[model samples]
Target: MLRRKQHRFQHNREAHNVIERGKELYTTIKGHWQEYFKNDNPLVLELACGKGEYTVGLAENRPDVNLIGVDIKGDRIARGSKRCIEKGLTNAAFLRTSIQYMDEFFEEGSVDEIWLIHPDPQPRDKEEKRRLTNPHFLTEYKKYLKPGGLFILKTDSPFLYEYTLEKLKEFDGYEILDHTNDLYQSPLLKDHFGIETHYEKLWVDKGYTINYIKCRVQ
Candidate 1:
């Protein structure tokens, strides 16, 4: 309870910048939208989006896309919201909610692609089902991802990379477009996920390699 109150206080402090990212009121999305100067529009979802650095960076660099950064911590979203509004990022948003409950918000076939960046990689022997690669969550994501939509999983942990690799193999429809242990060694990583995460930067600084995959459900 104490922790919750602290988080709420921090979130309230930055309430002015964060537009509650939930879609429960999408009927008013366009109404409140700050018309971006860009002409093209594509929607992107970033699961487990902590500070939303990736979401905001991508939105700033690519004004042609709309980026939704999802994280459960209202306090963390507050920090991200400050950066977005300060940058005048018209194409980015931050949501305060659990990723497991995401399907309730995004409409079916509405999302263009996804960026699964540095997820917790839940590893409790009995909690394997909670991992993002769990089949149940995959099914939920399928409802939102458009046909041929891309999925990018970027991680510094070999365990998560290999685990997700096996998970994708289990899905007959998924086609692995590209994957590698050290994406910096390959040319495709730049084409897929774009920039790195805060943890990813630390990993690279510590000489840790990045393993990632870009795929699609056929």
Candidate 2:
């Protein structure tokens, strides 16, 4: 494990698509996002992007929108960044950082949308604050999202699905766009449901149903 991690770290150092600690402009990437992509297109964030399946897939299909896959693991970032360069994808990049500090990297109202794809459910009652759909994380996400921007979540945890719905009811600044306990059984929205993460596939193969929630931040 140590050797593999070291190898990934070295590769990340040489990757232009991968940005990690010690990068000069890592903290101030928010206002300069368009300049980084060399375009004024809308920005989309994929939080907790492991292997960056959704990030790479979305960027490939939607060249008009820039996608940044955010995760703390150097190994995961290396995998995604390498794929982006190999595929010649200009619209996708990977950021190695804790999701708790997203506001430091993106300016308020800078992001057009956010994808909380298959994030940790934090199933225990004591860990509720750490859940991505918790009120605290929702507030952090809203800081970067544009007015009326979409906050989309896809998960396989029933606890998380119910928790998110309850939190959304308590928060007055957001309105539910749509939600489903079983994504495959309901009418599918192609754009949001098309990209599947590695963990998502594993859960589905084990007969677990996926849940999704879409809300607009006011």
Q: Pick the candidate with the highest lDDT.
A: 2
Off by over 4 Å in 1: 1-40, 192-194
TM-score of 2: 0.95
Residue runs of model 2 more than 4 Å from their true location after superposition = none
For each candidate in turn, the TM-score is: 0.83, 0.95
* Backbone clash count for every predicted candidate, in the order shown: 0, 0
Candidate 1 local accuracy as lDDT? 0.75
Superposition TM-score, candidate 1 onto the true structure: 0.83
Maximum-TM-score candidate = 2
| Superposed Cα deviation of residue 133, candidate 1 (Å) | 1.2
Quickly count the clashes in candidate 1. 0
